[model samples]
Target: MSTTQIASPRVALVTGGSGGIGRAVAERLGAEGMAVAVHYAGNRNRAQETADAITAAGGRSVPVTADVSDEGAVTAMFDRVQETFGGIDVVVNTAGIMLLAPLAELDLDDFDRMHRTNVRGTFTVSQQAARRVRPGGAIINFSSTVVKLTLPTYAAYAATKGAVDAMTMILAKEMRGRDVTVNAIAPGPTATPLFLEGKPQQAVESLKNMAPLERLGEPVDIAEAVAFLAGPARWVNGQVLYINGGVA
Candidate 1:
């Protein structure tokens, strides 16, 4: 959709905006003329670069930092955005961590750490979005296609995303009268550092062929899906969009 489609300036908070998919989402929203908050956890410089890119494109943006799992910090992040852009109209919770391990080999500490940022972080951010996002706004949470793919070494990561899926469905119901749409985007085998970090070359090549598209998903591919939900897809609430190029 064109930037002109947005009648008024909408504000968006994109968590993990320093990272691959999150950066794409932030930039896409900015291009749509939304005042964007490029959120980061530790990579302040990268987040600033994202914000700078948006501003250079003649869009309004700022870099904000917060630990998504911390309610107080998340709340503060929201306040900072509101103070800067007036009010939040969209929230894309893309701040997540992925640790791959076979179920039997996964350490409890790894499981807990992964869940802390993935599950708890999404919940905390969604909770704030539920209360703070304006009417006609949206809450876009991130899930993974692994939930359905049932990948062997993705047990813990998939479990966290499963929790996200459940929360998104129910949150939509809870927002019935609020006019705020809630949904999740599940992307399959995206080409991001998080996905490629420890994977062997052969394994990566195998995953690329899983989809009929014959390629790993791109960050922009996921961002395009987010743009739809954040802007024009008002009737598409409570759905889990699987944007995996026919990979079921």
Candidate 2:
């Protein structure tokens, strides 16, 4: 990892920094002068690519692989972070899985997968952050606007994000005197591979135009918001900021 004379660079661990929103979040954190730990569950190649870009541009990053659902793995991931970067000052939980199906038709496998990552994984990472992150550090969690929309076929996914929103508020209070902040970002229809997979071109365009902004969100759009939450958003805690382009 690289260092500067002005201040010791802060280390950030971004879970799911392999692709899509996670990639942009890691890059944005790097640009903000934070040494990042780009954590991925299985996609080391993509994680390394993100880390390499940061290091190449004079910032520093390390790619750590761990399944957040596994308590042992999450612990190991944090251990590695401390070993490599001295300590973690921020943790962003971006690793989530979405399973969309009506309540009745929902497969138990899909339900378990989504809950395991979106809910349990969030808790696992947040616990580590609570225990490991230094005072004045930040924890940023991802929620989704679908929770607000209460959309069909997103029952289980919405429930998980609901859990996230609740956790953010509670965790913020738990860190009351510690100078730490916890917040959840609920984004609308972002143009990530996970969301844009296999849609017809016309249907994609229609969905794009559904938002008041008239286009699907770019990764930079969400990244900019995340950067603020991780840096300048000190007073904003225990709140769910919706970056949905005015979509309900």
Candidate 3:
């Protein structure tokens, strides 16, 4: 039999699947027997590596590319996935950018750049997912616990996530009776390249100690939450789940 014929009926499109946390979520969904569409903004090679890993582990996947902030590009990516896998059962939006500066010192241009990717990207993908995902599916978005922490340099970044949290709840209600759950995962101080890029050892240690578990969150930790919401968490709609190890 052909691989596509034998593949699982479920399909998942994971945006930013080349990144740390996103890659983990994609692989976990793949392991759950869902055919995955790994979406990358630019790094097709890394995305393909993720897909290859999934395929090696007995799952089917393809690497897709698009700028998540562009509605047309995102829609095209979704269309391609549907054409390949029949339909989408889950949509996970994990593409985002973080630029830290105190509100007083932050450049408006930096804020706009972050918002364009984080807020606009989530909105664009969620819009497509709402229109396309099959019932009994899910739309998982990325948020940050920093919204509650209210850290000084994170004002602009947190604002973007605040929008995400608000949108998540409203989208859940908007999808009423559609059997599709909309939720956001708010992870705190995850040890991804994006989070660790320029931070010194001391800063990283401080964040690790803040969590009661006394360690930085791993990509797998957040991925486990994605797997839950993507699958059997039918009743867990319209909530921003904080996977920060008791940090917030």
Candidate 4:
């Protein structure tokens, strides 16, 4: 690219940026000239690795640890933004946990874990973005197609994302007249660590074939959807964009 074509950078915060779709979103946003705040729940090494990759790509990023579900931790995480990037422009709430158990078999503790991270954590990060980000900034939350599929064992996990989708619409309306946008992305089946857990290789293969596209989504696929929502897709607001490869 010519020097004259260089774009000015912006600030982006991606919770759970250490792994999975969060990492892809951070890297993609970084490539788009957004300085990244890579928030991790506990994995400093992975978060730093993500930040290092961004730096190697000629984009700026910083790794910061926060629970995302904890109000104080979430607040402190934003405080670092004040020091590192002055103010934030885009906030992506990708920090989520998926605990699969049939509704009758679900444990309360597992339910809390999913709710605390997927639902409450999203709320914490989104509320922070709502309060602090600039006029054209955004709040993007992660949902899952499991909410639509109603997959048997995913009862608790799906419940949380269902709530996220509902809250996203309400929050978008709550923003009322602000130039900023709020939206959610419900990815179908992505090839990510979380998606692979406990499944045999054959099962994974079969899952991939379940999509009409005949392949599981890459993390980058979802990240690209997120990039559009966070940056260029201006008219798309208060909607849940499902990147499911037409699985329905």
> lDDT by residue for model 3 over 1-248, one digit each (tens)?
11122224799999999879999999999999999999998889999999999999999999999999998999899999999999998999999999998899999999999999999999999999999988778999999999999988999999999999999999999998787889999999999999998889999999999999999999999999999998878889999999999998
Go through the candidates in order and give the clash count of each.
0, 0, 0, 0
| Count of backbone collisions within predicted model 4 | 0
Per-residue lDDT for 152-187 in model 2, tens only?
888989999999999999999998777778999898
Q: For residues 1-248, what per-residue lDDT tens digits would candidate 4 score against the true structure?
A: 11221124679999999999999999999999999999997889999999999999999999998887889988999999868888888899988877777899999999998899999989888888899887777899999988888878988898899999999999999987667789999999898889898888998888798898899999999999999988877678899988999986
Give the clashing residue pairs of candidate 4, or none: none
Residue runs of model 2 more than 4 Å from their true location after superposition = 1-7
Provide the lDDT at 186 for model 1: 98
The list of candidate 4 runs beyond 4 A from truth reads 1-8
lDDT of 1 at 92: 98
Q: CA lDDT, every prediction? A: 0.94, 0.89, 0.93, 0.89
Ranking of candidates on TM-score, top first: 1, 3, 4, 2
Deviation in Å, model 4, residue 101 alpha carbon: 1.8
Pairs that collide, model 2: none
TM-score per candidate, chains pooled: 0.97, 0.95, 0.96, 0.95
After superposition on all CA atoms, what RMSD does each candidate show versus the true structure? 2.5, 3.4, 4.0, 3.6
Error of 2 at 109 (Å): 1.1
